[model samples]
Target: MKRLFKSFLVCIFLVSISINFNPPSLAEPTSPYIRYWLICGPFKDADLNTECIKNEANLSPVAGQKVDGKRWRRFLSCEDKLTFEKDEVFGPYGNSVAYAYCEIYTPTARKVKLYLGSEDGLKVWLNGKNIFTNNAVRSFCFDEDKIDVQLKSGWNRLLIKVSNITKEWCLSARFIRRGDADIKDLTYRPAMLYQLPVKKVEVSSVQPTEPKNKGMYDALNAIDKDRSTRWSSEFSDPQWIILDLGKPKSVKKILLNWEAYAKNYTIEFSNDKKNWTPVYSTDIGDGGQDVINFRRPARVRYIKVTGTKRGMRFGYSLWEVQAFSLEDK
Candidate 1:
């Protein structure tokens, strides 16, 4: 009995050490978070300071922390960006040496392009390793700095230092480009804020009202997980494609990959295959990959995209149709 007790104690001790020291990583893929936990200091060039830039633990974020002296919090630039005068809008920043750090949480390890815009000399670091540096004096433009970065599959650190001796002092950043271009295709939310798991859902059936060419382009091609194949509807006034997501699902987002034909369209959902409910609609849709976000979650099994206008004289064509559900994490 004494020997058995000693072995049990050793096993418990080993398990505790592993659990405390070896933190398991989240295997599921997650979007990059763009919200930032910011801390700034005013210094001068030629005599730069590296205290804040060296330690990342001081900058790591905690939920519901009040913003005050030495600690500030702000969300990244969404569709609109700030000019020189808007520097104070982001935080308590002034015309001098300032350092900004934005930490993003990703679920998968991959490479992404970090869109950043700033003035004067700037230095950047990712996960304690330097990735980008622009040593020049220039004006801040939208997407001024495009740096490719490899993000880990969990909590990642991003830090930036700027030396502004001329012009305005500001920064505009996004995971991708901003403005209407973003509206057309912005399905993934930045990983900075908390979000529920959302991905492409599987459909049980896909059908079109009228295919352009007889039996050539089927509606299933649009949902077959292939990009090259597409679904083309016959040349007519009203054409649409519908998908049944197996059973009733909680859907909150939709994507339209048009082939220069869909200039106007509407997204409708229904449960009993009748009494349809229109969730989102648009009149001017540029021919490209576009994303539509539903402010309210719709529970339905049937999802349809009805096109009213065409960019050209051709029929309404679609490269792909996607649906997703985003809930509180």
Candidate 2:
């Protein structure tokens, strides 16, 4: 009986050890991630900081080092940083809402190392532990080290310090999640909003013609004697050019150019010319020449071009206008 009791106790001990030895998987929760607005900074402007803190309710001061003459700081809470001048906001999942990935772009020639810091720009932290020290101007960049650890399924705050010693200060950051909602769905739909008719211009084709310029019609018929030097007729104004695409399709890019400078003009599209929606335009510049990249995902048959300020005549001069469908390979 003594031996049997001893064996039973040993078995119990072994079972207890086995239960404690293996740990549970950290990824048990499978709910979709939530989207959070990221905000940052007052730095030189205390008023901005106060407003951000009020709006976000997650403000925290980060400590940082001084590299060169400029002072730097890192904030864990999104409420303390400034919006990126360009490409500021992004998601982890390539514009989707699933995987969480964030990157920052900084303009500086020198190599930079980042760390998290505290108030008065003196403390630093990494992976929840303090590390490194320096005094330099902080610039923004895509630092893999700064984000590798803090990233999780839901909203995550990334704090980083940048050092710049090369050129003028310019910084930008972007964050995205993998499984987020498709931006294409939340796209701007003209039908939902009341909008005025916007003007645009389109050139069908431009070919080499006779030296005497009689506009687009003259150039199409003119023959080129010298193969090297071809007479090209350019169309200056269209008031607005309309194209019948025949069927609704996805447009990836649009290129517009005005031979001479034209005043206020806008680009619009529609299924029928009567009701139109503006897609691209220019305020004031050399002619109305521009390449517009739009994120609007929609189907339409007609594209209307219109002029806003009519006194100043502006028309598009095109060698050719081409529309392409986006493909995934």
Candidate 3:
């Protein structure tokens, strides 16, 4: 009896260790659907296409926390159907917007199919990048939309925005395993009020060739934050500009506002500025506001924009070159 009791205690200890330390791994692919969410809303005006509905989309929320001066709380759905009604969660008012935040954990990095359904309109962001959106008045059904998402190893943040146009306000999401290759080790957890590490960055200087007009079209104009100003290069096929971000930063996104755009270009990053690594390359380029989001953040101090083919007869003229990190940089 003593030996049996000792063995039982040993098994209990092992289970506790696995539950605490090995939280990411699972014995089998259990009920891997998200059922709990940290939600808050009823900010009036429920237009999914409008910016008003996405005001709190980028927030890192916790249970019982206040967002935009409104209280946020954790809500659990007993059934597969999820609701974000004005009176149910945070509303007694209609024609408003609500947000739901959740986290997913994967043992390995892989692409997975996300099946989503929603009523009215919806927008979704995974790891700070907008992945899916639909602006339509409709009823909710299972798998109304399917999105292919590449989730990195460990935890991935998911933010959902649902808008109500005086009717049903709800959304549902789940992961559909892709045959046998589907990840068996997957875990879904409630997002309570956790914050991810935010990367930092500082600009040191910008290096570009003498502009067509030195003072009027200077290299510094690109970073001046004024859309009216522009940095124009000499009329040439191959033009390049390098920006030193002071210190190494985890770069995740890049935005370029082009006046005279490049038809072919590559956005590269480096530490020593000698060896360059291309994060983005384009052969068929469109002249406009170009926004690039990297699946994985790159740690670098130097960024270079090399253009080979000009969209216009003039050289590459940029109104702004903005680099963004995970958080504020």
Candidate 4:
């Protein structure tokens, strides 16, 4: 009877532990894998480099829109590998092509890396510009290609054209930081609230003499899209630099990444390179990054910055200079 009672207490103890115990889970690392997309496909495409492929691959997709009788539909991919053949939108196709489109919104302009994989052949377009293409016949693998891309400050468009010669068809793509870290400030949307027609203005000329160090700290380094290099002036007050935008562009904001900053500076705009108008000025300046926004947009071809007081013992130096203009999309 004592043994039977002890067995009953043991059963009760086991049941109590089962009811109260919580198992530990080894959580998966955070990943920014794109799961939502708009897919349209089964187009007849044999050669990936032909004009027929180019015409179809460059297409901009809209949800519920029809292209060659195939309506664009929403696809939710639960797996990181987007297996189109296994999905309802596509099933067991051979020697054909398809397209996937997605939009990513960023709050700021930054450079990011794209990890992509495709079965058979693939082509990619970003913001109406063809960014990547491969005609190699291969199976789908995770992160087969790593492409560097610059994301604009607002909504950016990403389009993928995938081809399958035989068997299965699949693709995988995601955006990550330069060090392969997950991006947290991205929002996936099918449509943009509004679009900004922003393009890079070509730098026509730079003035205020060449750097004494030449290639090390040249005048062109400030706009070379490389933050590791910088343009530095001589160690003197009243140092200045001028940049010609080749043509008049509607400007609203300017970003200055400073290396050796200025305590007092004035930014001026000019149309003919001779006459200048002050757009922004500051007396108390801090180093690091400075984003200057104008009260109203200005149309100018020339931008000049003059520094009257140095923040440190060194001269005025800039790691990067960027200007932004927004127009109707």
Candidate 5:
């Protein structure tokens, strides 16, 4: 009877242990890859700690300029530490001008926080707008820039320009949840967003051909679909940028993403491309981002911005000159 009791006790103990033991997890672990689109360059005589690196305006494919050996490649990072030593990344490189590193990611939550570390100067753009920028070259430290970003539900673009003033040009990035927890239960995708009608207008011209910085203040940059690139005229009044919308398309709205130059301006339209008529004029233009909607759609081929008075000592400057029609769309 004692032997039987002991056997029963052992069986009971085994069953209890089986009931308490937890099984291995069948859930898929989160990925640790930081996918990025990277491009390096061979540049010279560029400012080290400045917004110059962030703007790829003077780089290749812009203003007929090219970065001798500029090549873009897709990269996925799987390491905890990021570095650009004499051995690893674009080393033996001098002051670079046109280096670009960007990534588009979608997160489970609408809001996220990012942690970044870099050896030198870095500029970050969220949704094509400047958010955080460190235009100073210094030693690398973890969590150098901690930023909280509101991500759009579907997709968001993050553009980073890391400048290599010295030999060591490195960058590291990571995302965390609201409570500073590790990123989990998130989805990763290579983002290809649907583009709107935001691009270079077919034809753009400035009255004063030679602006303040002709290299940067090109009429082409204003329509290059880049906010960093802008068109600026001389520090004088009566400056205008004529935009030929290819052919006549309904233009009811005009968004002037200005750079604090034109305070008073008028929007003129011309159908025959010779005689022009003023549709709307703003004397109280505050000069940041002004969106002007016409009383009705203006079906014209030419649209011009004529500056009546100079806001500052500088002339008219436009970052992005865009036109859209709600009815046409």
Candidate 6:
């Protein structure tokens, strides 16, 4: 019929060029998990205008976009300044408490200053003294400079520094140590409106018999005695277990079993005792019981369970270790 109608219009022009050049996998919608603090370059000094004036004058942005979120900006270049050596320590609210409320983002706007130091204890300032000191005693000192500061055009100078370093507690703080085209961004929300509800103690079964050291007896025989642990089988290596929430509590939901095996694991969160942060992670590998939901709720005393990947072993076994506060609602 005329070459079959030109072969059906060349198969409709090759199906409209394959539907406009292959476009069909679009399902990327996941945005819910914000937590930030630390609004300044915690410094020991390599001098980049004192780490760009503590990362552009203590910029604050607890969440994201909103009159520049929290505010502060003025330090452009030298690669923004982010260095840690003398033992390394960075926690501007990534963990470690002292006072909360975070969110900052200063794309532009200058005039900033704030500095703090510690090795034993710290207390800082900027608008209250440009610089205020506390017991500081680990040795790199810089406290005493509260000048005529004013930054406002899109997030100005708002300083605050606190430190506590005794032995291996190296503390460092910086802001507007210098300035130019500043860039300070931070936005974290979900402290549960400043959460404060954790007083429900009663998890004592006195069980501690399973340590033959096959990595602590496969993590104490994969949880029992009310500490809970499971995988059901399908694990090759990489296993971990550590819990000591005997004090500070205020967690939410973290129940996993992933027995059957598919692969995926990463859950780290710590307090004092050392310092670790991963929050919650999973691949769900089609195993089994897996629930990890938290959008800003954690007070932790200590928790660690590692397993980067070892699936195909079918050795997943963890039963019960439930924890919930805030009236367990």
lDDT of each: 0.58, 0.34, 0.71, 0.75, 0.62, 0.41
The best-first sequence of candidates by TM-score reads: 4, 3, 5, 1, 2, 6
lDDT string for model 4 (85-120, tens) is 873558868888888888899999999999999897
In the range 43-108, model 5's lDDT, one tens digit per residue, is 556654444433543222221133444444333332343454433244556576435455444644
Please give the lDDT score at residue 289 for candidate 1.
Answer: 88
Best by lDDT: 4
The predicted structure with the larger TM-score, 2 or 3, is 3
Clashes per candidate, residues 3 or more apart or on different chains: 6, 46, 3, 0, 0, 47
Q: State every prediction's TM-score relative to the real structure.
A: 0.38, 0.30, 0.46, 0.51, 0.41, 0.25
lDDT ranking from best to worst?
4, 3, 5, 1, 6, 2
Which is superior by lDDT, 3 or 4?
4
The alpha-carbon deviation from the true structure for residue 49 of candidate 6, after best TM-score superposition, in angstroms, is 32
Q: Report the poorest 10 consecutive residues by lDDT, candidate 3.
A: 22-31
Q: Candidate 1: which stretches are off by over 4 Å?
A: 1-39, 44-69, 75-79, 82-87, 90-95, 176-329
lDDT of 6 at 67: 33
Task: Please list the residue runs of candidate 3 whose C-alpha ends up more than 4 Å from where it truly belongs after superposition.
Answer: 1-32, 52-57, 91-93, 180-184, 191-329
lDDT of 3 by residue, 2-49 (tens): 999999999999998988773211112223456667776777865666
Q: What's model 3's overall lDDT?
A: 0.71
